[model samples]
Target: MLANADHVMPDELKFEGDKAFFFAALDRADLIVHGRNSYEDQPNSPKRRRIIVTRKVGAVARDTENPNATLWNPHGAAFEAARAQAGVHTGTVAIIGGPDVFDMFMDRYDTFFLSQAPRVRLPGGEPCFDGVPARSPEQVLAAHGLKAAESIILDPAFDVSVTAWRRDNASSAARR
Candidate 1:
């Protein structure tokens, strides 16, 4: 996927609302790409084109139930190659991740959707992004020219929706 997302379940996501929408979107994706850790988190399941990006695993046998699943390592190139591959095969792509993966491709991402659970806090756990010092998700996206496009207050679960600043703006791209 040409985008990044971080979700805080229950609060930012609800079993009935946000989570339902999240998985439904995933189901509709032509390519579901995720980091190694995220891949491990999921119960091997079928439905979409699942691609796990990691250098550590080399490759793993496709989950019997999910024959469409496969794995590929971005191999230090971030996801240029993987993106190309996905483009050739499918139009829709989704990226689920660990921080390093997200940071690496955040700038080029066409959209970024973050589900923040306000008021609640985690004492100590994995960060949403790795290798970089603490930076608010909004700041990072702003630096990449991804401004908030939409925000929804879904009662039990309030989620902020963000898409690319503008889908076709070549000028907005942070030219290297």
Candidate 2:
């Protein structure tokens, strides 16, 4: 499990099919969003533009290290502003997770891709979403108004499957 908040992904959690699916989606995205803690060094990661959610800055700021990355604090500035800062005008936005970051965008997500690894269990490990272990990721997504679509098996060997939980826009509109 995690020795700290940003420990490397353990071998048990790695899924070849999931990685392929995720990176393919990311390749189609114009902008990517994730928390500082979830920063992963992919083969062409720096080549992809992204917005890094962090409290280190009060508002949107240019990432000193990566020219393609922008640091944003959702509390201080609007997402559109951050998007512009990240040079993403029109395209898909891929959100990589680390619990708190996913929670921040929970309400706005149109479709949440959930990959379940049934065999992998970490009693005290960090959850994919907040209030996990007790509430479960599915519960949290359902609580946030998302309904699962169809389950796609990523890896039959590992029994890893992914489901796209779509937000009910009609119900959301009524709630608003």
Candidate 3:
């Protein structure tokens, strides 16, 4: 949840501490997935395979600028097919999301890394999750049967921290 309450991710919300933590994690992912509006902040990372979820494309289409990226529409094409189109046959999938994209993958994530900048508050800005502001992001995650791991402080200077959420064995079994 990287935006303000108004569902807009303003430029001012980007925190350097969060980026360091986020980019490092992205390095371990085989494929990155995000909504059209949600993009990787690193522009220089070369050819990172990704899927851009969008409504503009009927199902799946090649991204104009990046050959490693495929535009996918959930309503038109199955996510499995899109993942394949992104050239990731197997390995971990990373979701860097906007609220709708996060909501779409509720059942599929093995882990969710939620980072917060405690000192910065966007009163009328976007919520991390769609149900946020109404029910906190933590509440939404709990409702989805995800258990939180210990929170780690990423950057003390900016007061940024991250928590990892994973479904318990029982919850995973139920999901399967």
Candidate 4:
């Protein structure tokens, strides 16, 4: 799943790196799972493929112009269903998320790819990952069942770093 913490009204579609990562991950899956907030925040564009998982069945509509996307609730069973679907592929199944959704699925995800903002600050907006206290993003991921798998510094212009983690299944102490 591709995600970022930005102002709610911000056009995240314009974020080149985030959007590029999102699309790249999308190409690996025939299905995409997203939270309601992220789903509702979608911009009008063609060639978008998505599925919205919400509490209500058919609670929202897909943009009329976005022919490739579909909406569904999965009644909070999106994880199981997505797992079933993704099991067919040895590739990845991303859980692109807003905070609530991330909080819900973080422990269950096999891995997480986080794009960290070292010094960037926002005025008023929800966080990228909720309930995680202010600390190094790496430390936060370690608190979950994740261990740093890779790290990359893209353009210095963005002041952002990309970090990847795979679930730590080795030991009980590894549940960070």
lDDT of 3 by residue, 1-176 (tens): 47765666666657677788788888988998898677776764556898999998999989988888899999999998998788788888889888788989987777888887777778777677877788988898888878799788878887788999998777666664
For residue 54, what is the lDDT in candidate 4? 60
User: Could you say which candidate leads in lDDT?
Assistant: 2
* Model 4 residue 41 distance off true place after TM-score fit, in angstroms: 9.3
Give the poorly placed runs of model 1, Cα more than 4 Å off: 1-15, 39-44, 57-66, 76-88, 131-133, 157-168, 171-176
Cα deviation of 67 in candidate 3 (Å)? 0.3
Cα-based TM-score, every candidate: 0.68, 0.90, 0.89, 0.66
Candidate 2 vs. true structure, TM-score: 0.90
lDDT, candidate 2, at 149: 94
Candidate 4, residues 31-102, lDDT tens digits: the string is: 556676664333432344555556554444443444454444555445445445333334444566766667
For candidate 3, the per-residue lDDT at 105 reads: 91
Full-model lDDT for every candidate: 0.54, 0.83, 0.82, 0.57
lDDT at 140, model 1: 69
Worst 10 residues of 4 by lDDT: 39-48
Q: What tens digits encode model 2's per-residue C-alpha lDDT throughout 1-176?
A: 22123455677888899888888888888888988777556797999999999998999999999999999998899989999988788867888866777888898788899998888776667778768768878899999989999899999998998999998888656643
lDDT of predicted model 3: 0.82
Pairs of residues at least 3 apart in sequence or in different chains that clash in candidate 1 = none
In TM-score terms, candidate 1 sits at 0.68
lDDT of 2 at 17: 92
